[model samples]
Target chain A: MDSRVLRTRRDVLTAAMDELVEGGWDAVTHARVAGRAGYAKATLYAHWPDRLALVRDAFDQVGRMPHHEPTGDLRADLVGELVSFRTAMTEHRLDRALAVLAERAGPVPELVEVRRRFVEDGERPMRLLLAPVLSGARLEAATAMLCGAVVHATLLHGAPPTDEEVEAAVDLVLVGVTGA
Target chain B: MDSRVLRTRRDVLTAAMDELVEGGWDAVTHARVAGRAGYAKATLYAHWPDRLALVRDAFDQVGRMPHHEPTGDLRADLVGELVSFRTAMTEHRLDRALAVLAERAGPVPELVEVRRRFVEDGERPMRLLLAPVLSGARLEAATAMLCGAVVHATLLHGAPPTDEEVEAAVDLVLVGVTGA
Candidate 1:
């Protein structure tokens, strides 16, 4: 609440991000974070109760990345959604967060819920945009193909698609899904 | 090694998987795994000196999931590859392992190398199949979309696509990519 308190929280989260980027999510622990931030465990605990809480707080720093508003032009909208997805991944560090969430190999119910929330939230617009145009398995397949391609192009290639590249990808997905 | 040594290794690996699935990759530490498997830290350490080593040893239990051998029939091979990928995701627990690897959220160099190796290995067949059929940027987009779609349909849909579904998806992707 106060300036010093806010500053400490900022420092803690910056360390959390540092840990997250440098070592991955598993590396973010209270003791490790306190050490990184030069704070006492008690002080860190005073603000956040546990590792998940701390992780959530650190990620929540970004809150929700922006989603695109559909312009009622199907092709335009598709390209827009893909561009937005790429932007969130590149600029907002969504890909890194996703990588961290994804590596939970086992069936932790709460973590599953969290992962679902993040993924569904990220692709919500894609679903909504495609809803009116397609349905059932076709829509599901289309959503997956488009979003998946974006992921591949972005994370694997490690670059956001240019507008022309995005348009080209959209055309490929569109023709494939629409089949016309 | 002796039978007793082999059994100890098996038990440690099993506990690592349990921790991986239940608590994620980070949860697989020597002390926790030793406790879980009812062994001493020294025993676990003797087998695996660190967490990554332990994680690698556990995952290597399912190393190099069977990739599809490319059939000459492009359509048949595409379907086969997609089906094989779906099988790997479901039967081999590759999805769980991938999730754990994905959530690291940091830029740990070795881990990045490991992740790249896993992703590339899994999709190697797809790339090889597409190389002659497509080239340059088209080839890249095609690979991403095809593999990306398989990931979505497999992981997000949480079911292996039926032959019909896989065919439909392959057809959609094929048309989009080949444009014929």
Candidate 2:
């Protein structure tokens, strides 16, 4: 790749994500990303048009969490997905990416779609893990409880929940799902 | 209140909140707020220094939720608080105020303090409601799960949970507390 103008649209978008990962949504500004991508600000704006647009593109590559192998233990599998969720939130700086949408007054629909996809992708593994044991509204509540626990913990604590916290949270949901 | 300069500090702060409530954080820009407060941008900037500072002051007055008269029933009390919470989030425009801090790459210390107070204020009733029935890690876990559910539902749906949804959530938690 040449130092001058020598890349495709993918390169610019990748650079936007690189900035987001390194710094956060604030880091995806026109000046920094354009310089990093070796594209003129004019060209970058021509495509993404704004910081939110660039950030939208960046989120496309997000929410692909690592696969959690189910050990055939319902409790363990549930905990596994949640711990993985916490890990992903922290390690990937998703807390900040989420902040991008979480701060809107009226959510921008396109951005909301990005958040929806990220959520659906994150929950897919959990859905698969819980389907056999839990179904319908119970499963929905459980998912909300577990996922909401992680989010609320972060909101309150300014960081992700600890592994023990995640375990305890999952246990709270377990009785709800498995009790007589 | 005079048309020109006939108010107290309370009026300005109130106006800032008015903007936050009506248009969210984005609407609290220097020009709009300064104009609304009947103060010049210089005056607003002198006090606030920046958008975040003004927002910081606005949040100081936030988090006073209405009293939920607790019935003797723990389940009803719990559901009452969660329902009140959902209502507050929708009515007070707390969702957008929260987004001001939520979108940050890092949680602002001062704003986080505001959020802390808000959470504590919101949860005080719940703490009192549950103290008789729960304590230690169980209490902590339950608090996180319930609050997290509200936050997660808002994030996923872009609106606060309906009253029925809040009731369903309390049931999910109640089962955990009262086992088979």
Candidate 3:
């Protein structure tokens, strides 16, 4: 794909997300998104072809944002992950858009696949960081708990966490895993 | 209230919740809820003058379900709370309905009061159980983390936890707090 085309697709996706947050998922029609992006409807169609595809691509972009690198220290890694999760929840519209999409997706297979991809991708780094600290079932359980907590704090509370809060939560989870 | 009237009101709320889960918050209009309950719109109105009041009452009823008693075992109590939270998320429509209502209420004093009451009621048992295990800001932080994790698991994953999952998560938090 041409760089310009990629850039335009990003623009349209970003614009669509803005509309989604501003007016809920119902407002994210192709025409509205195109209008918001200052692009013609034909241009959006040429790039995405379907609204779900557009949404999927946008969420994919969100899932790929740079995350904190694990430092081989479990507590530090967890704190870093919590901080990143908090920042994404607070500063990014993608989390809100994802919540709206998840509610509306229902049993739509394509949307379900997109959601799975989004969640797996988002969880990948955290899982890696936590792997060394936990074994077998404990690792899996801890990962779920961490991801679940961060997402809940952000989406439901509408507030990103402070460093102190993140640090405290990390400590709690770490003690569970290490029995420190 | 007459026992029969109370039963009928409960039926109405249950129907409204079913509609909410089946078709999101918008599907729970007074007429549809009344229809689902086999009651006339006027009957619903007699019970609740407005949809907000009805939703508020329904949520309050749902929220007031008995919490797990603190077993003097911190891990056990926390696990019970997590399980109950998961059950509420999966079995009741109140969470989604509250999300919709929150948007509508948006900083309104009545809504704020309702929210305060909800949080206080939910947090009371948690505070009591966790107090023996944690103190100061750590107690509050652990409670928030546990609440956030359970809610996220329910709302985002659509999975109410099994006892095993609840025990695992609670173990993680409690171990973390106690060990730290």
TM-score for each of the candidates: 0.73, 0.85, 0.84
Per-residue CA lDDT of candidate 1, range B11-34, in tens?
999899778766776678888999
For candidate 1, give the docking quality class from DockQ: acceptable
Kindly list the per-residue Cα lDDT of model 2 for residues A1-180, writing each as its tens digit. Answer: 555433556778778877875665567898899899887899988877898888777777554767578898878888888887777778866666666667542545566777777777777888787677676666666667778888877755576777776777777677766773
Lowest lDDT 10-residue stretch of candidate 1 chain B: B102-111
Q: Number of the top candidate by lDDT?
A: 1
Best by TM-score: 2
Q: On residues A1-180, what C-alpha lDDT tens digit does candidate 1 reach at each position?
A: 999988999899878866775677568898999999999999988888877778777766655678788789989998888888888887767677666655541453345555666677777889898888667766766777788787655555455566766776677767775664
lDDT of each: 0.72, 0.71, 0.69
Q: Is candidate 2 or candidate 3 better by lDDT?
A: 2
**In terms of TM-score, which candidate is stronger, 1 or 3?**
3
Residue A113 miss distance in model 1 (angstroms): 3.0
Scoring only the A-chain of each prediction against the true A-chain gives TM-scores of: 0.76, 0.79, 0.87
The window of 10 residues in a row where model 2 chain B has the poorest summed lDDT is B1-10
Between prediction 1 and prediction 2, which has the larger DockQ? 2
lDDT of 2 by residue, B1-180 (tens): 455433545567778888876665567788888888787788777778887777777766664667578989888888878877777777766666665555542644556776666667767888788778677767776787887777887765576666666765677778777872
